[model samples]
Target: MEEIIDQNEHVGIVADDLTSAADGAGAFLTYGYQPLVRRQRQASVGAPVVAVDTGSRLMEEADAMRATGQAIASLAGCRHLYKTIDSTLRGHIRAEIAAAFKASGRPRLVIAPAFPTAGRTTVDGIQLLHGVPVAQTAYGHDPVHPARASLIADLIAPDLGRMATVPVSATDSDIGKHIAGASIIVVDAHSQILLNRRIAEITKHGPALWVGSPGMAEALAAVVGQSPDRQTFTPPNAPRHILVLVGSANHLSHAQYEALAATGASVADRAEGIAKTASVACIHAPRARTADPSKVLCALVDEADIALSRQWYDAIVATGGETMSALMERLSIHTFTLVKELEPGFPLGCARLSNGRPILLAMKAGGFGSVMTLCNATNAILQMGRKST
Candidate 1:
């Protein structure tokens, strides 16, 4: 995002994870609204569009509900409040939406979790992935929030309490006419035109509460009359090395890690006790389930020697939210200077160390990007560094 430091801003977003937050902010970034991705709530309220990552995707149901509810309640003052969910239907989607609905105090909650460009669509309230039910996709094996069914209604049946439900249809003359007086309306949007049309019509009367992925963010930004700017990018100076950290148990991330290993990078199983001499290194977290995720992550960070990482590594690419948070904690980094999107689901930027030096940092959602996404991201950071200074 470019210019979001003024008063009376338009959009505010609550994201469940870091990558989702970055992707949402990147949407505003493309449209010239300087977007800020904050790890903590209420950290970027001054900007025109603030995307906050609650980092609650892996929490227990009760904990996730409480955290999501608090996040939504805290952001009630924004002109347009948007809840960004993972397009793959991971995390506590049902509970989080219900929480946002209750906290926003709005009469209606319009849900459209489709990102057609990413092959995620909602037809008749069932979430389909690449024309197949999401339950049949690789996400069906997700460790944390395994999606066993593709029906949106079935997926969210637990938390959708007593609210009037409406399923939208594309053939309808105006989708907005059906948005009112409903506790939750699942809008069926398979394309940008439909999304923009429905969103514009829904909010035609006044402010609205929106829920979806980054696709919705882009559509909403466009609806607010913000045309994207044609901007050129400048990369940073070259670094000593590149480090890739894999933090998710998702099969997609595991495959990506294997792809990284195949590239001849020095790959290590545990992060805590690894010594590195190679220009490129990959630290792969465990694939098996752990009873205590936070403790395990912290131990890994401690063994990986994060304090010395900034000195030896020129660029850092992390694949999941918990991994990103652990790295930040070990390095004592609080804020990131978000540059722009390196790929569809990855945001490339820089974070400053206590020594005042900047290092390239790129984050990707666990299930997003291809097997080569990590390698490409690392190369992009290296290229950017070469062009800087």
Candidate 2:
């Protein structure tokens, strides 16, 4: 058994991917917690909130479980542990959740995967995106780790032991009734207010593993209280040049790319040999579907690597979790100090390279954000550069 520390001031969040890690941590920013997103299972002592990216969403079930367990074990000192799952029910949810439950030594696991801000809500144990079942959404056709079921219970059945579903309308007493004698409780939340109430009730019940999206994280931050004093770190100088890498084949990402290009940003199908004529340059994967997602990811990474070798950019905007993870690995970037959110669920952080050079990094999920999101991010980067100068 791992030695558990009893300190409620610190929080540990384990996410299955890089973007989700940042997204999960970003919520704490409101409470004056300086969150750090680490790519590995290393300890970052003294950080108010630490989010570790297990990078196991696309891995084999056993591999995902092992990775999640190791990550949770490394965060033994944190009294509060949160597992961030995709709102649409992507990834190896069962394996990772079970690993977190076992590794954290928590008696029960409370799951509430709702992000009303992003139009994700849970009702009667079923997950809905923009009021439609997630199975009928674009996420269902994800190139990798597509959601097979919209019902949260059906998605993680048989492996997580006995489970119960608590509706959003459940009062404090009602919530207590559902949590009793249940190893896992899935709470339904359709709005932020209800989500916060559910989290408060569930947490009041006892110390159990909390699992959900960023909305849950925000609620956790509120329940945990604010830090004594806000810790401030100066961000790196804004980049005069920005590189936008689109590795997701999602239609929303494609629309964002097109919108950015329409703003006069240079666009290219490949990252290599693109001239630095514009302040912002975008390299995106072919719009056509590819049978092998791994190959497309590898090629995108290689192209981005080659482009970086040829020219230096002040900031990098990566749109997909896999793309961001691959790029960070190529650049040997394992740690990111989150500055703030460029947009909800879109985080801007300062990452240090192997050579100790700090660069600005902004990450967004492929399926997230509106068509103007990339354009707005690019403009934000430019505005930051002007302010710094």
Candidate 3:
């Protein structure tokens, strides 16, 4: 509380005892996800809760932070203690809430479920997890948590909507090998940097590449999608798709052309012209392989196929968990901000968003994974890698 006050920001002190102190401030006074100031003012009264736990162990760590917060909130008091949603950090929050519940032996623990703050988590179930006194569900996803809606309306003002596809060559193809008759047509305005990266990669493909202003269809002409959804899909499809090849003794034999040929997609027959015009919203489309999951898979395959391919790829193979982690570690940062811990290094692998908690990834594959299907792993790499470029 002091730190928050010192920082000169909204100080939200949770606890039945300190309700008054946080009066003008945001208060979980009612004890739930959104027992905001307005709702607190409108409501006549309510009970209290003692403890709460978020769902799932999640990599076994989400509960840590929650438990910690609960511990702190327990110290506050006024009449009620709002237990936040269940989260991996639930244990920590519970410890704090437990303290308050133990003191009051009946503080109202409310269910406040909503998308967690960018840096926070939500523990949907509060009363059951913690033996607190009373429970009040304020908000939820599908059911529309009333307490939650109240605050969001009071704060944000909600608006929502919407996908798109970039056609390669506009021409139709008669050949059976080609997925589409046209060339690659990428979304021009796509994440500019990523777009530029893909453009640069296509350029590297040399004469095999045919320019189409910018988009997937054009890029695919020069390359092939490695994932199931890249080109021909069953039914549902994604607009942005990329393809990469890493066969032939894992690049030792370096049969680049053969690798490109491995995919049966053919050139547009009687190909005339592809529309160069592009639209916005390309920002989210596939761009570049900043992490290179394919490289990781290639290394893994070559490492195992030594007798089959020998020294051809002895130097550039990575057929192991460490290699895969190294590949996705970069992009995974967006998913789990605290992901520097996952950077590939000796001794300790890296830290990643396991189930939900932040746990350091260790090498020497510890637990036995049942379906360690290499195909699924390959497809996973292809899916993530194609998005890179």
Best lDDT goes to which candidate?
2
Runs of candidate 1 exceeding 4 Å displacement: 1-7, 41-45, 135-141, 148-150, 153-173, 225-240, 249-264, 270-278, 286-296, 306-310
In angstroms, the error of model 2 at 134 is 2.7
Query: Better model by TM-score, 1 or 3?
Result: 1
TM-score between model 1 and native: 0.82
Give, for candidate 1, the lowest lDDT window spanning 10 residues: 1-10
TM of each candidate vs. truth = 0.82, 0.92, 0.17
Q: In candidate 2, what are the lDDT values of residues 77-102, reduced to their tens digit? A: 58688999999888998778878888
Q: What is the Å distance of residue 144 in model 3 from its true position?
A: 22
Candidate 2 lDDT (Cα, 0 to 1): 0.84
Summarize candidate 3's per-residue lDDT along 1-389 as a digit string, tens digits.
Answer: 21111111111223211111112121121112211111111111222212121221121334433433443333233222233322212222323333323333332221122212211111222111122211232222212112222211111111210011122221222122221232221222223233333434433322211111112221221232222222211111211221122221222222322322243211110111111121100001012233554553444333323321221110111222333233334324111111111111101112233234232221212111222222222233335335644
What lDDT score goes with residue 278 in model 2?
70
Ranking by lDDT: 2, 1, 3
